[model samples]
Target chain A: MNTHRPWKLSVAGWAALLLFAPATVLAHQEIGQITGFASGFLHPISGFDHVLAMVAVGLWGAVLGSPAIWVLPVAFPVTMAFGGLMGLLGVPLPGIEIGIAASAIVLGIMVLAQLRPPLWAAAILVAFFAIFHGYAHGKELPEGASALLYSFGFVVATGLLHLVGILLGEAHRWAVGRQAVRAAGGGVALAGLFFLWQAVAA
Target chain B: MRRAVGTTLVALAAIVVASPAHAHLVETGFGAFYDGIAHFAVSLADMLIVIALALFAGLRGTRAARHAMFALPAAWLVGGALGALWPTASIWPVSTTLSLALTGALVALDAKLSDASVTAFVIVAGALYGFVNGATMTPGGAGGLALLGAVCAIFFVNTILAAEVTVLPVGWPRIAVRVAGSWIAATGMLMLGWLARPTLA
Candidate 1:
């Protein structure tokens, strides 16, 4: 896949960027950290494991129906927040990557198999997995990323990911759509297996 | 060839290791007034606290909403005046975030708060929050204009949000309000995480 650019071209590109770099220096880079909405929003959605798990949350909630529909959306973020808090405190919760990957596998199966647990039980299960995600993200949250807009974007993005799952779960309205939703679960499970393999291997 | 590789490697290394975050005074391209507005706008806890207060009031019905509309801005103004006069300890990142979480949780529950209770909550919260805001803006000490701008902004935002929530229909719209509250609640907790995180420096 001839993806590599010629060295000369790369060097020239570097030179061009370097030339404009001084302009950025004059644009208030020294005052303080500039907060980003896109980056925060992207953090959760950017990784495959996180996306699959978060979406699975919505899918499971939709399939479970009732209070969970709204409750799961709320629970995951708040629970994940505690997980993030734990990570910030450097409180060790081992197997973070494995747990995240496992969450996808388990949640995907919940949708694929249409498992229905009690509300409290489901919340606890989901909350347990949420800690893994929160810890991984919290540890990686970076130094200057501390601001409200960033947090807002991050939280909103998580809610949106759940929304995607719920919308897809709406397919359960019909038999064919139910099959489609189950197929999505199977697909998520498959992807999760790949991630699990990588985590274990790592 | 080696020179080019080294240069590329250096640039890549620079990009990878760069940390571009700190808390410092920034210009908002408008003036102190706009600076105040932007400051409030950019703040997560402050914005969440106001939204939670408004949503809590709105969910409690019109009387509560009305009281908050009047009480919040006025209390904030008075507190801001005192803050500008004498700066006090900053309780923002912690106290404000605590308020954000609690008030947000209240909104999410759509709790049936008494009108008097709602009014009292808004007044004390507003004054405390406004004092912190005013103290922060006093770095410029430009005749309290920025603080006034922030206060005006607080008033407009509170009124508009509370008004809209007050009029929401009974079903999905109300559910959406609750969802929004939960999001705010989650954001507050996450903000606390950020606050507690160690900086690179």
Candidate 2:
């Protein structure tokens, strides 16, 4: 039990750092011609809000147990693609940035509270947020880029982030680790609050 | 476990280490083959369905996986044939979305359907995928090569997924697969809503 303390602390500390780390501005255009697979893959991972929300979705799913472990992660990219399509077609969904920030806040709070809503409820929550995330991805797509390849890259990146969350969330299997996960959730929620403030303030 | 991990590592390495010339050049002959592969690789809707079907086959265990290995490609070929005969209309995006949703739900539920039922599902899935592929792809001089490439690519992906998942240690890893299934289903449902949403008048 004593030996496990370090492992637990490390996990929690990492989650805290990830959530609370000062935001870095990514120069998507400066990256230059994000036209191929590599660029698309990097896009989702590039944004701090996207990363937090995606990871939170995974962490929350892990905490929920059973089917959700897969469901939330899977729904995100699919719905995001839909949103991306909307963006591509020039369809309007207002306040996309607000929605993206709200996702982190809301999902982070869900984890922090250790809330386990019904499966359908959870799906709805994530799906609503996914559109914004996907739309943002679509909106950023380079002119004349291979839409398919770009989407593939971002989806893969998004999946990897969810995987990270699941791996972190799996810590809940241990009694001591459960609290650690909750603490991580608190960190995520705090990050979300900061993001929300920024969104609103802007 | 080591073997599965090794296979994945090898595949990733192959992708990373491959020459750029092997990827971007669109030419005749081999280029058409590459084009075919690229088409399937990037078609999100199709890829999702293939993945869902593979996941479903994996959840069903090895027997279903075996059946899927044969049935999916054969049905795809049949679908292609039908498409060649009357390549009139493409399948609706909604249909593909529905298929993905169904496959995901099946995996999430972990229902113990009969092998025949599973095979039928795979057949339908294959044919549907085939029909779409055939309708969209222009069968030029390299059409056969393109078809072969697409089939091979799909086969490779599905096989890896089904094989690795079939061997996963039960408990946490297995539960993770089911969770993935649920996500697929949720995505499908949301896509349906997106499709149905009324546009600004």
Candidate 3:
């Protein structure tokens, strides 16, 4: 490989730039404190970890096909609401961060492996992670927050991500699309590994 | 060369450092108007009704479907005005669910209603949803804006559905539309079952 060819050299340079960037900085950027409906909506989207895990759930659901397509998405938000409520009520659950990280890793692998668990099992898997995600939000809920409105914001955001997953997973209906979906799974799995590393290191 | 390298490094740092750890509920300056739209958007029941209505209109074809586009907005606005002005003490609580079931069933059957019948269905559906929206609206400017947003959403959704269905050719795509109707109907029935469970218990 000619290191000096313009396109190749630029690609190498870009790869180097990514590799050299500090994990902390590469992981997330601070956008200052946001609150209210926008805050709730932005919450899931802002975090790389949350985005990876939630999208992974959708991708897996799509891959699993019918019933699961709708089932997982529905189960997640409802169960997540329950988790959020638990947080609001000051109920304690252990290893919430670990669980969240594990979600990304496990769900990513599930997509990567093309696992087709029974619909109930898949629902249970995503629903379990949704709690921690919800709890994280619930615990940090702003003072004087309207529970109803805040819940609405996050639920919509989560739903949109799932929709993305389902839409992308629809690619499976095509041969080329199948490979792309699997590649996306691999990418998510890699991100999950990164999150796991970050979690363990912390 | 050194300066270019520095610039690249700076950009990369900016990207990495800007990421946040997790989502939290934060303030949005949108206020009640956005809230109304948000409420409508997230209301699964409301959306389901709109989708079913749209699917029905699409199946009904051009002349019949146009009635829905016209009648629905007019009725919705009229009903909204009534609800806002009179401020009903209680609404038909099951109206939404029932609307879903009725429309879903219609879609599932892929029934071809007479133009008048289709017109009647559109008006009734429009009035019911609009009334709900109006009743939910807060007083004054925000309320007015909210009503506007609701009408826009409803009009937009109905227009899109009615238009798209007319254009969709017969075959698998059309069949898929009917299948969607079946799913919507199934969901409504499931909801009804849940609602009925309390009585059964």
Candidate 4:
């Protein structure tokens, strides 16, 4: 019936274990799967341009509403796959960096202005941008272990970025929140301009 | 009573960790029957393809899902049996990735497919997977029991996933599932691209 707070008990127990327990053993061997998955998952979200554009895709989709909300998400991956194939086959597309940065600017503008184009046109635009992103990432190979699992993590991370944008875009349903969404769009566009400059400078 | 319960638990644990007697079973450190289950469960390519197909069927509505539930495992079993008897090397990665991409693409699109079409799709996918899985996991006629375990695994995954998606309401939840499909498709496509990656000089 007598009880200290649960947090206190946990803290005491952890302290006792830390002070009394033997030093932890570190593994000497390389953990292949961990490295593979980490590399794959990081690739899409790692770059500034990549993350911004992907999020913008979802943001634009959400602002568009209904089928575009879903269609853009759908089209992006499938079209990206085709672009990946082209890259793998050694088909060259010029100005990949320019394309990637331009995606952020265009899509961010769409979000900022609440530009609602026809669904087909919107889908094509997103799909077109997806190609550049895919080609940029297409040549990357997981570091020789759990390659398939690596792809799973990579794709999931990319999709999660879209989910984040969609969740954020939900703010547009309200008046004040709409302003916030627009502000976020402005920030994205600014970032895109920076990226575009870097691409051109290089 | 406590000692008896403890002893029983220990015995079950021992049984679970016991080395397999059959050579056909994949050595997953889980015993013979579980090895077959592990074969189905552990391989992302096989498992995700089944998942994508089940999801696609489910999105098509209850009728298509119902057809998938039976068609998938049944075709898998028949194909597995054939493969077990006529075992060959299963070179799966490229083919598996392509198939997974197609199946996931179907789900991502939220395609409206008929019951018959769904049945055929699942049957083809299930049988092809079963053949490769059976060839790889079980070597010969002696591995019938393990093959049964694999079939059961397929049935269980298909049933649960398809059932859940069938009952999902027509909005955000459904959209979330479609998102999952796109992820699967993207992953599969990425793997395919990896196959053609430029070799370092």
Candidate 5:
């Protein structure tokens, strides 16, 4: 395994950058203390469950390879904008909290299933779920933040995570690595299952 | 397993650190204004439809089946434009509920439609949602933006769930999907219950 590959280093470096970036630097101050971008970025990354689920999206995309690899990540942000609009229009989504938690469980399972859907199918599937993801982000956009910028920031971050998964997926060309990634997917699915149970019981 | 464990641990750590930031906005005794905006912004109809679509998609294993899914954003666009054009009252629960219910029912049937049929369905559905959103205006300064954010959050969350469904094997996937549907149904029921609760005399 060539650890010195530039592409690999670039991805690793980027992940490290995001991980080490100061919360204050990422924080948006547009609306009061919370800019829409800051809030959106924080919203997904803040919750442990959300963090796992989102990263899993990238991982699964990587496993599926190619088009799905790209489409799913793109689908989330584009549809999310639409969902945000619905939120703006006063269209409420019932069971938001539970829905949010379910996202983790559902996407996690998808990774474990390793279903390789076509590009178009992947787009549609991801888009459908994007509405839920977008609605959640729209609902929480702080009062004073700039909605456009907020949405943009989160979308960018989301894409990066997807890219991370793609890199990792590519690494799975090796048998040992593939098993490792699959195992990772299964683990994520299990965590989602736990969250689903907790949500249901509560 | 080690990698999974590591990822999970990191995720948990992140959540613990960010927990304090999840505080709800304080009400500041501005109930009349906030409540009005809240009602207008939280469309029960859209939420219901979204939940239904998510459930249907998860169960059927066909995300492309529901072309009416496009209606949601189209409605939002029209609603936003209307709000900009004519600012009025902050609440429109009746119109909201009706539009969402119609959309949900239509989308439920969408799985049966051809591509062209699905497109037509989405157009009609979007218009209805748009019309309802556009006609209703919140009295306060609050516009459709807030509601849009709320709904986006919900959709995003559901998307994550739908993705998970794809990962699960057929045998056990149904159980998870059913659980999700039940969760959505329960949430809808709870909201309805809250709405129908007897108002203070």
Candidate 6:
């Protein structure tokens, strides 16, 4: 028995490897449908719209500074979930697409304007947009995917974007950096205006 | 002031330019099975992104700003619940435009208010936003969540970058803000024009 121990261990290792080999292969067979962690990670990052908006949330928060800085960021996601549930429930909302585009335009302008809203007012405005945004999300869930995992991945990415915005905004405390950051906002707003035009035309 | 105005004008211009291409993504004629899966992936991704943005901000030593960051997701949850419960579709042009206008005004106001006031304002505003979202969602299978997520992500990122970066000369930030505002107003005008196109045609 003692003599066989080393050989047995090797056999066990081989068996373990063999046991898991097929699972890896099987994982690859499924395509197009996001089934695992990787897909979850890729989904949010894959879309340009998603990346831009997530980062924008953080940037705006940082620029607003303090309460608005915090309020607006929180208002967006929380309200978005509510909108998602509505989409899931099969309710009909007219002009949702238009609303979504308008949100981009409006929010972009606010950031550029550096609008300093009262906390209550800011929350109210953001919540309104959140509904439409959430509904858009809920309406796009894929089948048989782990909702929790997917949510986890996207949320993490969104937070990172916000951090990026915050960092950029903080840099503005310096003279040159401040000008640079504001200009970036202007550039993005220009992009958004372009998008808005496209949305309206369509 | 000039920088702010300039930023607003630029943003508005972008919106007007981009509006036509900013169509919402919709899945058509798919079975419940497929659609359901799509919905799940999209919603999860959307919500996760929101949370992630907040978390990221929190981690970057903006600990003081965490409340509003956390409030965003919470507001969404509340708003989503409201939307699920009371689903309705109304034009609400005045309400919608007013909200945007108000936000713009507030951004400008922040320049004047004390930091403490800004904090308080954000919390209350965040909750109000949560309520509005909660009350606006459809009941089933409309892809509202995905749309909301996509839009939020888009605007949030764009605004953040725009506010933080300077594409023009040193004296352009304030001008840029006003430009963005004008651009937004222009997009609104364009939207109105598009709405009117059928009658004119």
| Top candidate by TM-score | 4
Encode model 5's per-residue lDDT on B1-201: one tens digit a residue.
445455556655654464333212433533434433444344434445555554554444445434334444555456555654655534444344443434333332334445554445445444444444544534434455644553354446446544554466754345434433332332232223223322310
Give the whole-model CA lDDT for all candidates, comma-separated.
0.81, 0.75, 0.71, 0.79, 0.53, 0.48
Off by over 4 Å in 5: A1-36, B1-201
What are the models' TM-scores?
0.81, 0.63, 0.49, 0.82, 0.42, 0.42
TM-scores for chain B, listed for all candidates: 0.77, 0.81, 0.83, 0.79, 0.45, 0.43
Docking class for model 1 is acceptable
Candidate with top lDDT is 1
Q: Compute the lDDT of residue B33 as modeled in candidate 5.
A: 40
**Displacement of the residue A121 alpha carbon in candidate 4, Å:** 1.0
Interface RMSD of 4: 11.6
lDDT per residue (tens digit) for residues A1-202 in model 5: 7544665455455555455544434221224324544664566566666667667777877888755665566555545556655555557687655666677666766776777767787667666665676666555655444433444455555555655766776666788887877777788778877776777788
User: What are the per-model numbers of colliding residue pairs?
Assistant: 2, 4, 15, 0, 56, 181
Q: How displaced is residue B195 in candidate 6, in Å?
A: 37
RMSD in angstroms, all models?
10.4, 12.9, 13.6, 6.9, 17.7, 21.0
Q: Is the docking of candidate 2 incorrect, acceptable, medium or high quality?
A: incorrect
Candidate 4, position A11, lDDT? 53
Q: Write the per-residue lDDT of candidate 6 for residues A30-132, one digit (tens) a residue.
A: 3432554455456546655445555566667777777556555545654554565565554677766556656656666666677767768767876786577
Consecutive 10-residue window with the lowest summed lDDT within model 1 chain A: A23-32
lDDT of 2 by residue, A1-202 (tens): 4675565555555544444333333322322234656777788888998999999999999999877877788777767767876765568889888898889888988888899999999988998999998888766766544444455566668888999998999998998888888888888778877887888888
Candidate 5 chain A weakest lDDT stretch, 10 residues: A24-33
Order candidates by lDDT, high to low.
Answer: 1, 4, 2, 3, 5, 6
